[model samples]
Target: MASIDLAIAGLAIGAIAALSGIGLLVTYRTNGVLNLAQGGIATLIAYVYREMAVVWGLPVWLSAVLALAVLSPGIGVLLERLVFRPLARRRASAAESLVASLGVMVLTLGMCAGIWGLGAQTDTPAVFPNKSVGIGGHHVGVDTISTLIVILVACVSLGLLQSRTKFGRQMRAVVDDRQLAELSSVPADRVAAAGWAFGTTLAGFTGILLAPRVSLSPYSLSLVVLETFAVVVAARLVSLPAAVFAGLAIGILQSELTQFTVNGSLADIYRTLGSNLFVVVLLVLLLAIPNLRELGDAGSAGSFSSRGGQEDTGTVAERSKDLVWRVAGFVMLLAPMLFAPSDLRHAFMVPALALIFLSIVIVTGYSGQVSLGVAGYAGLGALFSLKLASGGMVGIPHLPGLLAILVGAILVAPIGLVTGYPAIRRRGLTLALVTFAVGAVVSRFVFEQPSLAGNLTVNPLYIGGWELGDKSFYVIELLGLGLGMLAVRNLHRGRLGRALLAVRDNTGGAAAVGVDVRNLKLLAFTMSSVVAGLGGALLAYSASSFSSDTFQPIQSLLWFTAVVVFGADSAVGAIVGAAFIVAIDVMAPSGSSTLAVGILALALGWLPGGLASAVRGVIRYVAEQLADQFVAPASPIRGISALAPAALPAGPGAVAPSSVGTKPAVASARASGSTAGVAAADRVAADRGLALTPFGRTLLGLVGGGGTARPTPAPARANGAGPGAAGDIDRHATVGAGDFGSRNHVEGGHR
Candidate 1:
């Protein structure tokens, strides 16, 4: 009977996970977005529902309807229309859309915190009445029964909707080819909107159901939704039944694992696993899954967004200028040592964090791989450094900080290789999600476990008898930072850079060029992790303590956003961004920096290339201005000089009598050079001002006047139109109200 009760309890939790998984899958299948905002959306709706039912004293049903039916779906439509639609219109890569989704997540969480605060909301009223029922000779909670029914209804309804209705057919058609569907007169926008609505509604339902099982804190709630990724990954983002079954299986298995008992340290390990079974399920499933069923075009370059910087194809002389700029930037970093002791201590965080961001730049910016698990690697480095310094190894005694950092980095490299192997075939959002899952699991199972990381401490490096002070320590950090920057610069130059660029630009092309992409990816992951480990060691030493919060999964998200905001590919930008973040936190109230960064990341679509890249663009433009000022202008009259000596002589000799019909001609000739130049400039200015040309004006008039201007026929052809056009017009009809079939002609005509 006890076993049956536990099984029921586990199944109830699984049922909720099944709900969240189905929501994620449906959104992905229909819109081709993995919806990283699922947790945020869930958290928002749960809070709203709580506010309505408990705080505002609304009826349970009314609150549920308002929260689930209106607020949740509205959020979906809002995100689709605002954040996602622009990216989709631009055909932004899956990776960009993934980051945007993360932005939405970060934005919503910030809003929740600003509005509701981060404290646990124990008063979150459950809509389902607290009642029990007799089920096969055992008592069952009403909430559990309700959750099961909701899950079943959603699954069956979605399955039927997808397999049956015209809506489903249209959705699949749109998913296959959005432009093609539009050409066929299918309502692509409406279908996408419907998908968002349904997906978000399911999210709300799951959130409400799960709220009763745990205290409602932002972090805990978000983590719960993330752990459910195990089910979604198990489904491969395709099978509805599979996701549900996987969820239930994990829940039940987790419950069953609690029955076992072990002695000594093994017991502590069991307890950790038992409490964090869902996280374990997530990590295991992500690593075990061979490949994800990613949506839309698989070959689409969705992961690494091009920052639109001009490719540097300049000579060695020009390249030397770039080297000078880099050197100046390094000098600027070193200038911080002049600050007071307190300020210098704060500056120490910059190099440490900069090294961490540089790792992201290498893995994400250079190679177009998205990793959200760098925090996990960093945390491990700190732990390993502590272990080495504590003389905890079987044979080794306590080591100095420098030796410990080296050993920690070497120890951490294999962890990266292990994770990177799974990442060989994965890219974009799938890779990001998988890495995030790994980070979350590590946080819960290792970092948070008292038996593992609770006693971590930092040991300062001593040189002879001189212990490094804050100023000296900051200098040492800068040296490590410099080494990291040098390594990154090497990766970004020469043959290695070309190989990485080739891989980033096109994997197939890179392979065709004889690049070993798999090995390159693994190599990048290994090196990046090593650098990140070194950074993490410095971060721990700077703090003089180790806390699990330092490497929370969400911190990885913030760090990634900060890197992207500062221009992901720029090492100097990474350093600047780290300083910016640290400065923001020091100067502003807590969480303000997150809010500011979140806002900036949300607006990254319009800015393009991020704040760092934008600054670089400005600097380059200024330098170009100065260079142009130093160059002499060419003689404007030189082209005519070669042919015009005789002409000038003839004109001087013939200020001569104008012919009878030559009055207008003489005036026009007199208008040559200065007058003509002025007229021509006026015309050019007008064209620029109006943004139009003669041909453009004519086309605009034709289009505005509602006339379908027929194409002029070739002189050889009797009729202007091609054969079979009249008969097959409907068959070859294009999407949109305009003649999409003739888009090239329209575009060329406009140009």
Candidate 2:
């Protein structure tokens, strides 16, 4: 009977969870995006409501109406028009959409942190009074009753809207085939905009109701909203009824579990499980479920890092710029060392963060796994290293710093493989959800567990039988980073690299071609975990302590978004992203880096393959200009008698050199030091050939020698000055260097 009271008390939480899930389902069904930003949207609106109602002293009802009726939905429309519309028009894959969603999430968190500050606000205005009334000898809160009504009304309204309306059919059509719907004049964009509006409206409602229940803070409130994802995942991301039922049942069960009492670690584990049942269920459901009714291609995991049909090896011009990029990146990395002692201490985090970012590069970039759990592995690395160094683990002796880190990283490799087994048959958003679930589970079950992570401490690490200073430790960090880079390079090169690429590009084709797809995926996961573990260990060492909050589940989203914005596949991008994060955090306000990353990620539509690819394109253009400075044009020139008849373009479009009224006698004068003959050829060129067509001008720009002059015919050369003479043009050997940024390898080889 007491359990009934607790279950009733839990109704308020269940109702809001239901709304969150239903909102996610509506957006995904209509727009084919998982709306990873749903939680952030909710958090942002919550802050807005608090500001309007509490801070500004507006009436609660007015604040709620303005927030839900206007501001929240406006954000949805703005996001649709600004961030997502271009991607949808271009038919961006789920992986790309997922990154954009993360961008929104990061942007909203940044906005909240920037404005409200991160302190917990217990003064969130509640729409309903805090008092409860008796119902048949049981107490029920006004908030719970109001939420129950809202959930029921919201669900029934949505069901009718999605079924009994023309807009509903349009939504389904757009989701089924947006381009085809547009061809049929179905107003797909409008339908998508409507879907986003409706979804975000529900998100706002949930946030308004939820703010009073939880402490209003940027990260905590958003994380609470994310935890509700179990509702939709349990619904198989399709059925609204299933989501509602699952939400209520989980909520009640969690509430009911409080009655049970036991002792020992098993009892402690059970209690923790009850509190985090949503995360546990999410992980189980993701693993147990065979397949979801996802909208994108099954092998679309590599789509975010897609090279946009560009070749992997690229033009010779592109290759030439690599050395320059490499040098600049090296300088960027080393600049931190010359900083003042305090600044250098802060910069220790740069290399450590780079290693973690590199792990993401290996897993998501090289293999297209779309892992959002590298933070989980990284956290494990930190814990394992600390445990090893402190001799906290059973039957294990304390080791030196470097050795413990290595062993801890080695131990974490198998764990990554074990966790990644689910990825053996998953990709794209489905795989992303699976990895995120695994991460959430690990965070709750391991890192947050008091027995494992409580009051942990270790001595300063010694290197080579001596304790090192700050600068020396930084050098050690650099060495570790170099080793990690070498490993990434090896993974991205040779037969193994090609095989991983094959798996990423097309798993079925790779299997057809006899590539062991499963083994390669497992290898990628193992290697990625190793790198993350190393980085996580270094991260702990830098702080001289292990802290669970540092590796929160939300950190994974931030790191993944940053890596993709900087170029997921390039190791150099990881270093730059690390530098950017550390630098931005150091120089500016706390959340400024997050805001910048969010802006850059949202702009990923124009900057395909992220900043790294954009930079490479620019360098390739400059390289082409340099090549043009030296190499002669590859195409034939007319109106020059030094050129043989065979050298002229033979097509009908070709104009006869004789039409320009130029004579053959100009050949000798043009080929030698005679100024008069050169003038005659220049006159003809100025009248006709000097004014190049667009294609010819572009070719000349890329390969610059002898604009209108051609190599003298063998007989004509014999009659003129020797090859060493002043007017003699040495034949340009670089014939095919005209096309700048030309792709040289197979198109779209997993980027």
Q: TM-scores of all models?
A: 0.80, 0.84
Listed per model in order, the count of residue pairs whose N, CA or C atoms clash below 3 Å is 6, 0
Tens-place lDDT digits, model 1, residues 386-423? 88888865577878878888798778899989888877
The C-alpha lDDT values of all candidates are 0.71, 0.76
Candidate 2 global lDDT: 0.76
| Candidate 1 residue-wise lDDT at 58 | 95
The C-alpha stretches of model 2 lying farther than 4 A from their native spots are 306-318, 634-751
Error of 1 at 372 (Å): 1.3
Top TM-score hit: 2
For model 1, state the Cα shift of residue 172 in Å: 0.9
lDDT of 2 by residue, 1-751 (tens): 5988989866767877888898899888888888889888998999999999988999999999999999988998998899889999987767778889999999998888878777888998997888898999899888888877877887898789779998878888999999999999999888989889988998888888889888998888887888898899889888999999999888888888888887988776788888788888788888888667788544355554434423243334334645655776698778878989999988999899999999999998888898988889999998988888888878889877788988988889989989879889877777888888888888888898889887778578786678888899899999999999999988876557756765665566556545688888999999999999999989988888788877888889899999999888878789989989988988988778878888898888777678877877777677679779987765434333323333333343443322222344544455464788676654544332232211111111111211111222222221254433322221211121121223221111000
RMSD score of candidate 1 (Å): 13.1
